[model samples]
Target: MSPPAVPEPFRWTASPCGLVLECRPLEGIAPHLFTTRDAPLSAADLWRRVGRALDAERVATLDQVHGRDVVTIGPGAPPPAGRPKADALVSIDPSVAVAVLAADCVPLLLADRRSGAVAAVHAGWRGTAAGVAISAVEALERRLGVKPRDVTAAIGPSIGACCYEVGHDVRHAFEAARHAAHLLDRWFVSREPGTGIRESKRLHLDLVAANRDQLVFAGVPEAQIHACGLCTAMHLDVLTSYRAEREKAGRIAGAIRCRAYNPA
Candidate 1:
């Protein structure tokens, strides 16, 4: 599907998608700030929107599969079908706008200001269980020699706990992966607030919390992790959701790009 066209002199919206304002906290970063919604945008509108703000011709995006794959952006890229399979992409190059598309999955943006490196990740329950956030951070450190402390992150909107109902299979997967059988208890919900919720508890999985915990575990500063706490299922009018609307709904893309240093 083609992207929405964004006119020149763009306006940033908190949107139901829950974007962030980090580079210039008071005014926001780059050319635009957003997470995707079911909102229809033409190709010209979309590219024109991102390019004018980023001074580039297009936004780079990935085909997400809810895994821990990390792809570093370099020269000589292929089209969407031919690009390497990965849930995340990082780059020091400004020309590549790290982007990911999702519906009810978490979209994450990270930046190491000191190194001028940026990344965008697609995290779902499967990816979270697979430790994709840590994978992305580790990739940054291993591939580019960046410190977690220097990395600031924005956890964009997704299916929140209030609406992210999950099954025992999902919980068990994460618990088994982390080897912290206790973490399952910390993240689940039940009929009664204090009751043991192992088998009987119907849980609302907090995707943001899961990713935030990973960032913390990876040594990202507590102050630097910003979470947009909106639930895609709850706000169907603005954002898209596979859980709420199923295949009837379309997908929204999350994007971030490197911009030239401005002396403002």
Candidate 2:
């Protein structure tokens, strides 16, 4: 299949059976993509599609419990018995692709420019509050010896602040996460009065901003972090969004792979 024509920051690239979005900054360093709603419907089919697109021999994903746990995969590591209960996957093996699925949550991909190590993070509000992005960076540093300064991240299409309204409970969640409390004011926007009823006077949570800030706090340079800026809630035609589609919403995935090892 030929690469489809896509807009700025995201380019269409032929997968085995369909086209996926490739972040320009991550090109060459890692074979990664942010899949759209046009991709396959089933999890197995989606994995196969991603494998074909990147020519990866194997792919790894998670059960994605909105937490900070990071699962590591490599050459000698045993195959995952089941979807591990984690929100992030990291690997230095070129043949293995790590992916994360999300509907409204941020699907974040990170790559180490020097080591070629990569990670896929599923950062929903809960995971964001738990510092999932920072956890991924720390995992890379601890497991692969990749420093945060050398890492580049791409925050994929998700529910942007414009449409992600939340209640005080959401604010309380972040506030309770003392490590993230200082950043809450910047990530949450309180809706003005008359916008709706009392309960609807919600705060809009910026998942992307929260994740980006966490990455920066983890030491990734602000300029190296790229956000797709495509709001899933706003771009229903090309993306799936839980906020806009409710239970009927399908998921989009963000995947990344290391460069093939060359011993020569």
Best by lDDT: 2
lDDT of 1 by residue, 1-264 (tens): 333222222233443234322223312443335545533333336545544445555666666777898988643433343556789987666665667767788888887767666788899899989989999999988877888887788776678788778888888788778735555566666645675675575776777877888898888997888765657787666667888998776565667775642211
**Candidate 1, overall lDDT?**
0.68
Please give the distance, in angstroms, between residue 79's alpha carbon in candidate 2 and its true position after superposition: 3.7
In order of listing, the candidates' clash counts read 8, 2
Name model 2 segments beyond 4 Å from true. Answer: 1-8, 180-182, 193-200, 261-264
Itemize residue pairs with steric clashes in candidate 1.
Answer: 4-41, 4-42, 4-46, 5-42, 5-45, 5-46, 6-45, 6-46
lDDT tens digits by residue: candidate 2, 25-73? 8886898888887784565677887876777887888998999999988
Once model 1 is optimally superposed onto the true structure by TM-score, how far is the C-alpha of residue 79 displaced, in angstroms?
A: 9.3
Q: State in Å the error of residue 12, model 2.
A: 2.9
The CA lDDT of each predicted structure is 0.68, 0.84
Q: What TM-score quantifies how close candidate 1 is to the native fold? A: 0.81
Angstrom error of the Cα, residue 166, model 2: value is 0.4
